[model samples]
Target: MIQTSPKTFRLHIGIFGRRNAGKSSILNTITGQNVSIVSDIAGTTTDPVEKPMELLPLGPVQFIDTAGMDDEGSLGLQRLERSRQVFDRTDLALLVASSNIWTEFEAKLLEEIHNRKIPVIVVLNKTDISPPDPEIVKSLREANYTVIPVSTLSGEGICELCQAIIESAPDSFVNRPVILSDLVGPGESAVLVVPIDKEAPKGRLILPQVQSIRDLLDNECISIVTGLSNLPQILSRSGFQPKLVVTDSQAFKEVAQITPPLVPITSFSILFARFQGDLQTMALGALTIDNLKPGDRVLIAEACSHHPVEDDIGTVKIPRWLTKKIGGSPQFTFTRGHDIPDDLSGFKLVIHCGACMWNRRTMLSRIERCLRAAVPITNYGLAIAHSLGILERSLSPFPGLLNTLKTTRSV
Candidate 1:
């Protein structure tokens, strides 16, 4: 990884507080730059501002300065909502309070952070004006929170705040889960079938494909890359037998046809289903496709926003296949990028993309969001496999997921 990495690959630390609580100042101090505008007027920083930098021992980390949690008015509500959404991806939170002031807003923010199970460090800013109340500090300490008093004007206690964040970051951030190493051992061979279509980038593979190849190489395995047209010949005439064969989800049907039944074959999306999010839950959620009613609503979500071409997968193909299979034209809603709605009230099911652009924490957060809304969420690969009648075969790599689906659903 380079010094300037993607935001999804960085550890996200969110600075949250009420209006004029020196949240922006703390961010500027920590980053040693004016990343966010500092002003005396309340609600100066409306939307969340992000600053990405390299933090020692923790690698890349992005600090997010959010709007006041106590903003009031029509537009204020929207800003507040956006601020709260930051919790979805936050690895660590800094609750900024100043003048020894702690109100319902602060308490509510702390409760929300604790509810999300994110580690938090309470920051008492502007201690030069009014020092932290001993009683309040004691109460916070009793709750097992590390409270630090800092004056951004004088740059005091910034080191302590950074140290707290470094210590509190989750271990999973450093030690990430393997994409396919656990399945393919050292010295083993795996063939990757990448279909070069118009949708494919010129002279380059997609992120999932690149990451899969890199993972195999990192595990000391032999990776063979070939296009879909040559997959049959490769499988038939190659002197080497691969431990697994991975392909793009869109070509699952074709790959399944050519590959032998004994060879364990899967898609890039299926690999990500285990890498980024819950595999079994998503596999079980795929069962809901069979139970869709006439007027059911399905949400199609993608992580990256790209120009839509004719017969787009998320917009056109999946919906057409689903509607034809269900014998009804179900209402479909589309969302792309980071604009995931917090309220998933009326949606019966959510079909999400592979989320290769996002980190494990963000993907899990989206899954939890759907679960909280009492909605079943499945990814593109699982849904595609289920639609093509190869759901069981595609999920064969995972030992118990197919059996779980069998016991739960009639299929």
Candidate 2:
């Protein structure tokens, strides 16, 4: 049996260009498959087409071929808008352009990519029909852009294009941050508390729990897995002292009570907040819960779309806790998957999920947006612990963040 990495673990490379610029063709040729519809028509690809595969020397990667940025008309504009959204998650961007053509569309797109601080490679496709313009090439080079002139018809520059992608891959992806391994040293042990609830999959542990266990094993650390019922037994052993205790956010209060105060503790979602996003920012956002007033608007964002169970964490539990904490019923708006509202100004606070389904870049982009909107954003785990008045205790493993929290709380 072969193991496959999840899309969230893969490098996200987005290919962008105007209509018929061979964006799809480049993807098909490089991947050696017809991943996208390659048509001469301007608006053939009305939505972003994604292809996930192993790119050697770069590991797993997902190539996103988007609709033309310069698309016109009512429907065309919609497609163009969807293509623009791809910028938020793109780790590496391929700005495809036809050789001998340098227009505002390509320039404006490049500017947008630059504004986001994303690494971009300029691919002047269709070089067989006409050579690349020297002035355009020189201008791009002067701006420190890697310019690759390619003719997919003749297989020219395909190898070089792949090399450029390999080189431009983000450092974060190459050297990923650990979920919890850094907290526990080699030969040390950590306890993982996973509760079996209605939302828990039939027989499988959740992604965060499984990944944390795997990360511990990979780092030569021992991982003790148990449910809320057995957590007490594991902690009660006289000679057994775990370096850390990680539990589901919902089980925070129980686990904190059972585990000794000397042992550092946290939740899987909180670990993910540091793994997938800025911990300090989310921690600060969690502190803003004290300022939430009655009738204040709150946005709950979930990365994975699913039907609501009876006591769904996002829909029921979090809202109930917030209502109790605020002593009033605040307006709660729920958004699942990629449906984050374009305008976030109406919301007083944005509470998001662990985002296990999304890459770090995507989560960071969302966090960045919330900051720009001046709205405080926090993840489910942080929000839960804070509302329960146990957030400071849950952050024990991360002393720097704990000290920061204490200082911020004093203010």
Candidate 3:
């Protein structure tokens, strides 16, 4: 898959439409494979279907096929919500409409796209069956939308459609990945500290750890791996003085204590902050730790869907650490998986997981929502380091940025 990594070039284009509007069919024709299941029934695709491929002019691209927007009933409403969720992360939106009908559903979706400032292409699908709608053409054209009629089955106008999508996509999303990789120069040494615990996957490293290592390798930077128990030893014995140390948030205390003040250090979560999320917003959220009232409500968010471990950081460890630091009991609400609470004003703060499995677009959208709501959102590592009273030390990696933020916020 083409990573939407800040180091790689990719365009995240999402395909959306009403039930069975040939969204999947259009995808199959474009990709030349049955990547998404096709069905006559509406709401067949409950979850967003993703595929990554290289288009000639566009280089690498990711396509997301979502469920119909007009789905009904309880289950359909849930599916509809899932489809809407894709909007926040999409760099480009393709609204697949049937030539037979154009309704309020498309208009509302377009309004949201406009609000989000995402460029869109209104696709009139199944053109082989019927002529274009005059009202649809007039309405969309007046609004300055590019509407193209396409036949997925007959394979008509597909080449032109692909070029149009490439033309409409933002250049920033395609180039963000490359900028992140350029932050650290080639041939420098970086250390990664990963702690192995019950929550840590057995016989395998987490996605974030592996991806960071791979990114370093790709840039020709030398990396040394160590566990929390022997991080000090690893630093002492390594041949070179490491330029950066990346660690798991669970081991932030020990890592911060052992590492010398000169050598830069940070967590995998911090790297995500700089690359996948808004670092400034999270920095502000971390500052809210001092003001958490005794009875104030806090929301703890996690992304990966699974049976949380007994020592889950998001559930047990983080809550325990915060309560211990505050020295008072506070109301805590836990929302796991994708069920994030809509009314976040009830909570004073929202502490989110590192979001290893989710893409950058989704993470930023979640942060943007928190910004819009005026609710502070900090991740597992920042919250942990903040509560432990060693945030400045934990953020030793980017001394310039970290120290500047820490110095300004320190009381």
Candidate 4:
């Protein structure tokens, strides 16, 4: 049986260009599939279309084909806004333009891509009809951009475009960080506490749990998966000791009690705080919880959308916890999936999910946005641990972080 890699693990390559500029054609040609609707009519793609495939040598990649940035009118503006959001998650960008056309649309798009500091490959499409203007190509090349001339109609330069994508991928994707492998060394054992609950999928474990187990195995470490009921038994086993203990954020209190003090403890969400976003920044953000006042606006953001359970972590539990911590009710706003608010400045604090469904780029982008808006941002795990008054204990795995937290608290 073959298993497909999750979208979160794939490099996000966004294809940006104007209407009817053969953006869809370029995507279809590259993936060898009709991934997006191809039509001569402008604005054919009203929403971003994503295709995930193995771009070998570079491994898994997600290609996002977006609507034209040059879209007009009210409805067109909405589509354009959606396309702009793609910049937040794009690890690499492919700027597609017709060989003969150089307009404000392309210039603005390129400027936005540069502002995000995303590596780009300029694809001058329709080269078979008219070779890319020498002056335009020279200007792009002089700007240190990798320019690839292609004709989707004739398949010319497709191989070169593919090669350029491989070469331009972000270094972080190439040298991906381990989720928890570093915490548990080879030949060492780590306990994973996963409580099977209503929110848990019908049969399979959640993405973060599955990925955690895989990470340990990949590094030749032993992973012992269990529930809260059996955690004590696993820990009490004669002559058996694990290097670390990881649990769901909801079960942190119980798992912390069951595990030995010598063993490091953390949660999947907290691990992802470091894996997907800036850990130190978030740790500091969690510190701001003490300063939250009643009625302060807080944004709880989840990367995936699902029906809220009675004790939904985001909508229900976390809010209850925060209210209890603050001794009063605070105004809470929730956002799911890619529906990030246009203005984050209104919020006093932003509590994000583990972001198991999103790439690191998207998570980091949100963090950067919060920083720029002067709103402290933290993940579910860090916030929960801090609220429970065991954040320092949970952070014991990283001694340096513990010291940093101590110094910050002292100050």
Badly placed stretches (over 4 Å) of model 4 are none
Model 1 CA RMSD to the hidden true structure, in angstroms: 2.0
Candidate 4 lDDT, tens digit per residue, 213-295?
99999999999999889999889999998899999999998888888888889999999999999889999999999999999
lDDT (10s digit) by residue, model 1, range 191-229: 999998877878888888988898999999889999999
Indicate which candidate wins on TM-score. Answer: 2
Q: By TM-score, is 3 or 4 better?
A: 4
lDDT of 3: 0.80
lDDT of 4: 0.93
Residue 27 displacement (Å), model 1: 1.6
TM-scores for all predictions: 0.94, 0.98, 0.86, 0.98
Could you tell me the TM-score of candidate 2?
A: 0.98
Model 3 C-alpha lDDT per residue in residues 309-394, reported as the tens digit of each score: 88878788998999998887678998876568888877889888777666566788889888888999988888998988877776
Candidate 2 lDDT score relative to the true structure: 0.93
Whole-model lDDT per candidate? 0.88, 0.93, 0.80, 0.93
CA lDDT of 62 in candidate 2?
Answer: 93
- Tally clashing residue pairs in candidate 4: 0
**Per-prediction CA RMSD (Å):** 2.0, 1.0, 3.5, 1.2
